[model samples]
Target: MTTRTDLLVVGAGPYAYAAAAYARDRGIDTHVVGIPMAFWRDQMPADMYLRSGPDWHLDANGEHTFEAFFEDRGLDPGEHDPISIGVFLDHTEWFAQRKGLAPDPRLVVDLTRPNGTFVATMADGDAIEADRVVAAPGVGYFAQRPDWHDQLPAARCTHTSDLVSFDDLAGARVAVIGGRQSAYEWAALLCDHGAERVDVVHRHDVPEFAKVSWTFVDEYVDQTLAHRGWWRHLPAEERAAIGRRFWEVGRLTLEHWLVPRLTPGVVHRHPGCAVTEAGSEGASIGLALTDGTGLEVDHVVLACGYRPDLARVPYLAGVLDRVAVTDGFPDLTEGFETTLDGLYVIGFAATRDFGPFYGFTKGCPSAARIVVDEMLR
Candidate 1:
């Protein structure tokens, strides 16, 4: 089967949904395809709560704020404790429906640029075409596995985003790598699930919390958005240098929140040490540290970080040479449009182009507005 639309959006996560909502409001014949809330529902741990809190809503328009959604659903946002993942998903679904932005829930298996339109092939044996395409796929494809991990078998090492069930590690010794929010949250979950022991390893001496100052964050956002043309005008080397600078200066360090949760001895801290190698031994794994030390464990959960791989994006490969990526991130225009005309990428992938706030919930509305205006005009 084949269908056509004015715009094709890949991914149904927060960014994709917001883009679709904006397009709908502007009277664009937009069609989005992807698993509904796949990242939030599948990747994130069920027990984990949004670190940003429920007050930080994902609503693009003010009408669909968390407070409003709660009221419309006959629930009190204030009364809810921790703001469960299930509740957030429910609210997203409700908001999507309320805005008349329900797109067919289909996984886009392949994307190809054919002539002037984009050809999207779905897993269910259907094809769709659109004048413009926006790859708003969520963050899972870019799971960052350190090079040292190649020594270990897949069975012993896994990214935190791949954890399907904590029960699988019952009574086992586990090493939760990294010192970010996800790392701490995964450790907490492992301990709660009866793991024999959970050790959190970090390259730094202590975990850091994300700097949440509104003024500082706002300045970072402005600087990032202001340099949208940096990728286009500068050489790849220069662009990468800028990305590293921004990452060092603007990104929140690990000590901000994760350090307080460490129960002195329970969560073993190995600061200033890096994982040199990883290998599996039957059901257990061995990790060689940079400080000439080794630790044996049954499982290793990597919360190291993420990077966008354009090759995984099926449709993007055809125009891969045309779309410039800086520091493994898509280089988008101020309006979230890529170098290739009619192709836009938002969310984390577009951070280098949009600014530091691109990945946060707050940036989604502005990104949606930018794309909607460009495509609907």
Candidate 2:
């Protein structure tokens, strides 16, 4: 059977929720597909804390905001300064409830434009037709595995997303590859779970564990709404400077809360190092580092982070050949419309043109407003 809608959003995360809510409120028939916040619910660590605060939310209208949820629940924002994953999940659910957004919990297996309209094939062999498709796929599919990753036994190594819970890792030594926030946070969680040892190896020096301001991104997001193609039109050097600043703050600095959990003896930091060789050693995974040292751990966790690659999205396979891309990111217009006439991409995939903030919840409202405006036009 087939159903029809004016717009179909291909993800049910924060981006999808915001877009669908805004479009529906504006009198557009919209349907959202995919499990809501599946990544956060099933992939992230159980005790993870978000880098963003309550100011970030999935509300395009700004009425059902996270701060507003706090007020409704009689909860103090100060008590959740560094919001826990559970609190964020609750807020997202509350916002969705208030907006009356119940996404269809089915996977879109294939997407194609056989005729003038787009048809999305659901996993259950059902189809849905829409005037336009907005893909807001998450970064879970774009994991950046190292070159030597395949050399190690598959069972012995896993990405940070795949190994969300560290409960069974007690008494087991681990090797965490990467020095970013996720890397450090995973190491701390392992320590907290009673891991025997965790060697965090990376090519850079230890990042500073301090608080930093993210208010600078607000102006850039505001600029995006004020001017069309604002980010892409910036001078090359200016863009580079902005990227460098983001890297310095977001990547080169770790959260202060992790310091207490990442004990020196339990979580060892090996800076200026990279994994030279990896293989199985008896029951453990053996890794040789560039620092002339080696580690024999029960498991290896890769925190190399994600990159944007449209081809990795399975459902987009049918339409990917027709979609224009550069450096793995879709070429999007100021309104997030792709080269395809009725297809759009938001979230991480739109970062290349819309700016890095689009990959986070803070840009959800702006992205929803821009895309819905284009749809109406």
Task: Give the Cα lDDT of each candidate.
Answer: 0.74, 0.92
lDDT of 1 by residue, 270-293 (tens): 777888878787877988888887
Model 2 / residue 28 / CA error / Å: 0.7
Model 2 deviation from native, Cα RMSD in Å? 0.9
- Where does model 2 exceed 4 Å of error? none
How do the residues 141-198 of candidate 2 rate in per-residue lDDT, one tens digit apiece?
8989999999888877999989898989999999999999999999999989999999
Q: Estimate each model's TM-score.
A: 0.86, 0.98
Residue 127 CA displacement from its true place in model 2, Å:
0.8
| Candidate No. with top lDDT | 2
Off by over 4 Å in 1: 208-265
Among residues 3 or more apart in sequence or in different chains, the pairs in candidate 2 whose N, CA or C atoms overlap within 3 Å are none
Indicate the residue-level lDDT of 112 in model 1: 72
